[model samples]
Target: MKLVTYLLLGVKKIGVIHNSGNVIDITDIVNTDDMNVLIEQYAAVEHLLKKICVDSDARGLPLADVHLMAPIPAIRRNIFCVGKNYYAHAQEFGNSGFDSSAAAGNVPAYPIIFSKPSTSVCGPGATVDSTLDPCNTIDYEAELAVVLGKKGRVSDSDDPMTYVFGYTLVNDLTSRQLQKRHSQWLLGKGIDGFCPMGPVLVTADEFGVPANQKIRCTVNGEPRQEAAISDLIFDIPTLIKTIGQNITLLPGDIIATGTPAGVGLGFTPPRYLAIGDKVTVSMAEIGELTNTII
Candidate 1:
């Protein structure tokens, strides 16, 4: 079932988005409004959630009346992000001349990983404060973010897929100049409000095997990026293995799979984000996550 974290009547609540486009308030029922706790205990609660979804007498709050938050609004730690996971985006970055992490070529031999501070996360439709970028070279990268449910260090005997909770979208905003100057990612990509994530988190069972899902991003309604999940140079399982080898993956951890090509910097003359630009990242199975620069 599709799940969400939202605000209704000035209270943060956990909800299930019913097929009718209304929200089934599960906040009180879940015993904890923290999405991390809910996910960590999902296996124990799945049956109840399913029963609620089909209950004819259950009341659903109108979707239009509530404010949507990122499916997991308060991520427990810095988000694990993949860089240049898509072949086309890899080549574009290598050619853009803003890349500093390339060893020999555009493509990575393994996943290029980085992290965005949890403070960087904002919900859908929230305004992205672009002033944080002194460089004024703000750019947008649309990516599919993986949300982990289980806690463990993935090893040869563990199946990484079992650790997945669900999926969401993240627009990995960047400061081109800072990235080029630092020659590393954190300073450039970890700006406050840089990560705008989620319209909702579609559970793994409901989202199904996502290898073929399409991800598209538009800037002020104009198409900029589009690619299938299959286009990634490094797939999800490989990413989980790479990161979970020693570090214990925990509930509420987000791994933003790298974006596909067609970012603003991909152009001969870059079309960086400007004030009032509306950037939208979408996956058909999930929903659109649109945010405007302030």
Candidate 2:
């Protein structure tokens, strides 16, 4: 099932996107308005969601009437991001001369994890603030983000997949100059309004296995990136095991799997984003997350 947080008539609400192409207002179905709360109570919440009152003949609110926000607008902590998880993207960054991770041959032996503060997240249709970077070398990376359901450290015998809550798409917008200068990703990639996520968060059961799903990115109608989720150098289970080995992952935690090739930097001259440029990150099950550079 696809769940969403939206603003309708100045009030924030939680909605279920029905197959009818309308959003069912389910905000009152539960005691809390927080998306994280629902995730924290996922098993119970899923049970209740199975019995929603809306039926086929009854249409709910038209999608155009409500403004969608990030599934969890105010995330509790920093979002974990993996860099160069795709061999092709690793090759591109290796060739671009901006790979600060500076692994032996562009690809690191282990996962390169970084974090983006909650303040950086913005909802779909929001304008990305380009002026934040003085060098103006904004680039877009389309990523399939994982939402964690349970809080625990993944052990050897544990199956990481069971802990997954669902999935969502996020645009990992970056400032090339800041990344190259700082040597680490935080400042360059975590700027406010850089992460444009949402429209809907598909539950794991509804999303099925992460494999076979393709992440495609386009800039102003031109196709820039395309790759299957299975193409990642490190898959979901490995990522979870890598991070959860030490730090205890909590419910509502977000992990961006990483981007594929065809980023602007992959170009010869570099096709950095300009003010007013449109970027749309799309996947098969999840809908497109489109944003404009301002």
lDDT against the true structure, per candidate, is: 0.91, 0.90
User: At residue 179, what lDDT does model 1 achieve?
Assistant: 89
Weakest ten-residue segment in model 2 by summed lDDT: 50-59
What are the clashing pairs of model 1? Answer: none
lDDT of 1 by residue, 149-216 (tens): 99999999989999899999999999989989999899999999899999999999899888979999
Error of 2 at 293 (Å): 0.4
Candidate 1 lDDT score relative to the true structure: 0.91
The alpha-carbon deviation from the true structure for residue 9 of candidate 2, after best TM-score superposition, in angstroms, is 1.0
- RMSD, candidate 2, Å: 1.2
**1-294, model 2: which lDDT tens digit per residue?**
899999998999988887777888877876677899988976876766755524666577888989999998989999999999999999999889898785835687899899888989999999998899999899999999999999999999999987799999999999999999999899999999889998689999889889879999999999999999999999999999999999999999999999999999999999999989999999889999999998
Model 1 error, position 263 (Å)? 0.4
TM-score of each prediction: 0.98, 0.97
